[model samples]
Target: MSTSTAEGRLLRYVDALQEAFAQEMARDESVFLFGLDVDDHKSIQGSTRGLLQEFGPERVFTTPLSEDAMTGMAIGAAMAGMRPIHVHIRMDFLLLCMNQLVNIAAKAHSMYGGSVKVPLVVRSMVGKSWGQGAQHSQALHSLFMHIPGLKIVAPSNAHDAKGCMIAAIRDDNPVLVMEHRLLYGTEAYVPEAPFEVRPGRARVVGPGDDITVVAISNMVPECLRARDLVAEVGISAEVIDPVWLQPLDIDSLLASARRTRRLLVADNAWLPCGASAEIIAAVLERAGPDAGIMVRRIGFAPVTCPPSPPLEAAFYPNPGTVASAIHAMVRPAAPAWQPDPERTRLSYQSSFCGPF
Candidate 1:
């Protein structure tokens, strides 16, 4: 944690996200909002709150529930040099707009050899917490991360949420800003003034000695808690919260991995070809072949993520899960922590498979 003092207001995670959007809109005229319920009483959560009131309908526009049409419209608007911020209610909802995004928005630059810029940011939430079922509960950001020409932004705290989001709004490429449904209520500190959160920057959340634990999405705070647990036992686990998932902050990650000499990455995306695996590869390439890495990613069980709450509790990654992973990472030799047979997307091909 390089931060000696916290800045901005201590507000909820949702407020930090909103503060980013509000500040960006205030700072740049090119930044504008368009989504399903900017004006409707039934908005997708409350992240879009007060924007319609402040910017007026001209700048803050609403669309019908058609994700495809709105996405296509945003792409065209972006090609015309107007920045558009589109919010889909959930990651699943984005499937409806893939044609516009993948075929047009994502391909426009390379398809034309840098002829045009798509300064569009599509915002969506991973709302798996509300028993929203498989459809709504999926952590689908990995799907976007797979696509080229699209940047992925996932912030774990109030400060990065504000900074990273402002960066996304200003970028020329199409970017995806994913917020977890479970994250909206949690609180963190955020600055009031509009500022810059440069893309591809990651934030280290805790200072530790034994190991460096890099966790993405909402798993960040869990990593912090895991650090606390290890500290109780005299092991220090440095925690890093990535503000930008794609165009990742490899420099920050390498610095921390070098300092700690051992790296553990935690993520909610699947294991075979997820964000965690990609980052583990980066660490090894930067830190050398002899670097010690224990990578752990938590996701739904392939048992279709059984709908039971107790089942979810047992299956999903939590503070306890992270604590156990870190403890094993620092252990001389672990015979206890067996590979979880029930988790999603863990494949032999991806484990420790990197450019190192």
Candidate 2:
């Protein structure tokens, strides 16, 4: 669909994903969907809800629980000119397929001297919910970003979610698209037809001057909440969502940093040597050290996520935590603004009910 026509509709994040799959599958004969319960009633948190009905069991089918073998099969299909969209219920499960992903799928094109293309899309979910605990709640984009031949994208909103998924499906290389579990229900204006958000771009969600807040995946919404809270205290925060992590738009990030002179990275992963650390280093290197810029990072606490509800709440950084961190970094002596505890608790849509 054209850009003008796409703006005429509104959609939930999960609906946008379903539309992307339906549109692409309708448009191309090579595209196929497979993973655990992709065609079931639950439909992988409803992202793949209606795919099987539209495309039939041959094109959209569920797979066995063998991540390694299934991933290898998808890689083989992609190598032979089939476009495969592999879905994982949890990003943590991606660890089981690292050998196929990092070694084979990621290295195929380069290892073969560009003689073949992988045209593979791996869709995985990463976010915290219902005390999912340490094993299931990891947002490990940093690990995939370290590899050379893979493209990694984490969309925060519905519009980008649809656009990026289309781009990944069409791209002739291996792409890992990470979706935040909490963002599946968030609604936004999306184009009715297919579109591409384009990889390697940084979108400034909230434009401000005092500081530039770079957020990733689910953290983008929390940062927006923080922006509103900080505004009451006269701190204007510019929020930048790095939609594509692999080919990161450093130019846009540096531009925001130069104008604000302060940057805070809010990522959903851990702190040490994480995406936050990499962004800080890149910004400082390009923006220059003499600029006297201040940089801080907020992410998962430097420990395993706790299973208890209250401890899990403390473990993950919420809007309140983000706002408090900004308040402290921007002004040391000012009275801290306290957000309502009830408001900080993250809520899921009624449709979202399980790990599947």
Candidate 3:
């Protein structure tokens, strides 16, 4: 076992994920990981690197290209006193196993009257990666959020990524840890020891009183940058990252919205019936329409993701767009303005070189 480096050190998001898996498997023998290409040379973009060798084929083997069967296997393993981490290379593929996940794994505990425990972790990545197009780049977290028994989390940074992964593994119910591919390269300070970030908690990225910006997954960093950009124009934007999507931290969001009297939800997916809509609905329902909070949502354009770089650029939201939206909501009477594109070029587009 590795000693705890509680002082912490900077680790990339991918490294943090790998560390979490490594530590957890070492700590609990029953905890095993398996997924499509999980033991391959790429190792799910290096997140599963060194895991197969350390744990051997029995615990860290790869599955066939069958999502449904593999998911069933994971559920069966979980029910029989084992913690299984099933990795889906792309969240898009998870759709093929919806029945196993939503119908069986999700409902087994309640259906069996608490006698059966399905402690499972499904790790999947979302977002555009080298023009993967609509088929591969979709963020379908909202679909799982609609389900009753599953817990969904989309961690934005290395620290939260590691903590959330650990938490999901230890959770008794089935948990989905959605990772935005673009975040894998990002780095943050993480402790060497295992740690769990309690779910249903929201982290305030930037503090302000003017407006509340609730960003999901990859949008967290973009919104943080947007916060700084809006500051130049004298608009104080409070940015909040809802780390867990299922059990949303509505109280934190409502408190922030109540303070600012304005709320902007920026999600990685589309606006209609999405996480953003759910959040806005929750705040409005809880705070009441009498709260008089101004709300707006920004996400993917209402169309399928495009493969071309130019179309892809238009499809996704960036710091410039977020800042412009914030400006419109806070200073509606002011002249229309947006940050210079040259200065605010999307960082993920430039850094991501992927075929995974």
Cα RMSDs of all predictions? 7.2, 2.6, 3.0
**What TM value does model 2 have?**
0.94
**Separate clash counts for every candidate:** 0, 2, 0
Kindly list the per-residue Cα lDDT of model 1 for residues 206-325, writing each as its tens digit.
Answer: 888788888888787666766766677677888887778788888888888877777777776556677777787877887776766554555445445544667765656766677777
- Relative to the true structure, candidate 2 has a C-alpha RMSD (angstroms) of 2.6
Overall lDDT per candidate, in order of appearance: 0.74, 0.88, 0.92
Note the residue pairs that clash in candidate 3.
none
Q: What is the lDDT, from 0 to 100, of the residue 324 in candidate 3?
A: 97
Clashing pairs in 1: none
* Residue 303 of model 1, lDDT score: 44
lDDT digits (tens) for residues 104-128 of candidate 2: 9999999999998899999999857
Tens-digit lDDT track for model 3 on 15-100? 99999999999999999999989999999999999999999999999888889999999999999999999998888999998999
Candidate 2 clash pair list: 6-191, 6-192
Best candidate according to lDDT:
3
Scored against the true structure, residue 107 in model 1 reaches a CA lDDT of 93
